[model samples]
Target: MSETTEEATLGLIADIPPGFIHAFVASLSVIVVSELGDKTFFIAAIMAMKHSRLTVFAGAISALGLMTVLSALFGYVATYIPKIYTTYIAALLFFIFGLKMICDGCTMSEDEGEEEFNEVQDTLKRTDEDADVESQTADPAEVQKRSKILNVVRRITFALFSRVFIQSFTMTFLAEWGDRSQLATVILAAAEDVVGVCLGGVLGHALCTGLAVLGGRIVAQKISVRTVTIIGGFVFLIFAMTTLIFE
Candidate 1:
């Protein structure tokens, strides 16, 4: 590539405002890390296991984009809302999400009970120890079969799209309230003559969301869904508390 072209590429990557990038990076990092072992990742994995990778990516990326637009819209409006009011609102949302998480935890506990029941059923169905050994290992063919159904659901479900978008917006925005990057964006907005901060916020959030989705996929490999949700909910609770304290 030409030197000029390289510089242009570099600039594009680094172009967003420092505040937006900073807030986005900080908030996004925390979320991505926390989500690494959380419910969203499990959902992604379940989708991945049931569908083509392309379908999962499409569903996930679409959700992220929709979320980005909503978050940016909220961020822009937040610019006009009094800082104190905005902080309070964000904190309230975070706390609510935390409470929701707690509720999900209870529900998941019930599901564990169901899982135990399935295990007992499996034990009864086995005719011999050898059959039990075979059953213990999941058949790859069966997984592939299950994936086909998941892919269909992912393709046809408008509700999934809506749920993913709403989840994305709620998670991202709440994590961002009174965030350092947001504060930085405000400062950068005052310092720069152009819409540098706005652009930066958008770019930063885009990167953050991408990582968040990717991180979710990674976490699904190692952790159970119940664990993921519990962690995610608690993290929101902590962030909410921080918002209350700092705002």
Candidate 2:
């Protein structure tokens, strides 16, 4: 029995390709550099200040996981197509997203500034309300009734976890579309082990996003979003040029 069990374990381990570790390291390094100072990092930090840190981390990680899976799938499909064509497509997307981020960082309209301010104010107000609710006292029966009612409201509005998850998922997903990280994932998937690439990419995203959530207000205060965006944009552009030159 022991021999059979040992054999089974070794067989499972052997199922992973020998190249998987290399693929994972490559994916992790590329994604970490590409994603640093990206818009989504700032978004995660901002959301963390207003929502539960665990929820924000969970949502951001989940969104990145989903995006990695999609990119890997797309890369797998690209394997069926010509490699050169997919490389070109990935390079083009990286360049476009880089340019767009640079432009956005350089320009911010008054309306956009006002909208951001209003959002901050609303978040602060909500935080106060949450504190108040927690501090308020009532009869046990009343508290029970209120809890029931709040549960119903949460169900209807998809508050708490659902709200945070939906917001984070949508924002991260939309922001990631055509971004360099996703393109890199596609490129890596095409060139390396798919499972390893996905795992490493997801791990990289989770680390960055979790740090952002934990840093929260301190990070927001210390780093300007525009500066981060510009840095990320240049990184994307570099990745694009490297891909074009090498691949």
Candidate 3:
């Protein structure tokens, strides 16, 4: 019985898809850092505060799954395109987005500025410092009544799958212009007699986004959304500069 059980356990382990490990590791690190203080987490927290933790987690998981599928599809296309060009293109896009963030960071519209002042004034009026508060705090019981698990699950499944395919297509199409990871995947796929690049890419992205979702929750507790936004913008600028310098 023991011998048979040992063999069975080994077989189960072997049956586990190899890409699963790689995907989990790569996706986790990247998503966590990127998400540490992202809009998605803010959304999740809002959901949690207003509804159930389950609902918030479900939505977050759905978003990450969708992102994974998109990355995977892009990875598949990366197999076809020439490697050198792919990196350059990805770098360029990052740089452009980063520059936009940097530029936007400098501007503060009159209405927006006044709105912020009012928010600060409100914060100053807080009678309880020990209890955290915000501009939007929904009652969980009320939100839970409106948040149906079955409906959310169905919606998430459909939205995540559809978005993944669409986003993947866009990324892959852009990759034709140039992306390093795309190029690397193409080379690896050709040499290793494997077509796992898409899976790896998906996994990488999933891991990263998952982290971001968690981060959004953590950061929301300590600072204002405006502060988080600035930090995110700064990070994007750094990524943009890195892309420009290296590419």
Indicate the residue-level lDDT of 229 in model 3: 38
lDDT at residue 225 of model 2 (Cα atoms): 56
Q: Which candidate is the best by lDDT?
A: 2
Candidate 2: where is the Cα deviation over 4 Å? 1-18, 82-161, 220-247
For 1-247, candidate 1 gives per-residue lDDT tens digits of: 9999999999997985554453444355334433443333334444444345445545544444444444445455555656667667766766776677667765785244234334433443453466568667878899689778787786666555654443334433453455433443333233221243354445544443344345534433334546655765776677666655544
- CA shift at 213, candidate 3, in angstroms? 8.5
Between prediction 2 and prediction 3, the one with superior TM-score is 2
Whole-model lDDT, model 1? 0.49
Q: Which wins on lDDT, candidate 1 or candidate 3?
A: 1
Query: Over 4 Å off in model 3, which ranges?
Result: 1-38, 108-221, 224-247
**Where does model 1 exceed 4 Å of error?**
1-22, 25-55, 110-222, 244-246
Per-model RMSD to reference: 12.8, 8.5, 12.9
Please report the candidate that would top TM-score against the real structure: 2
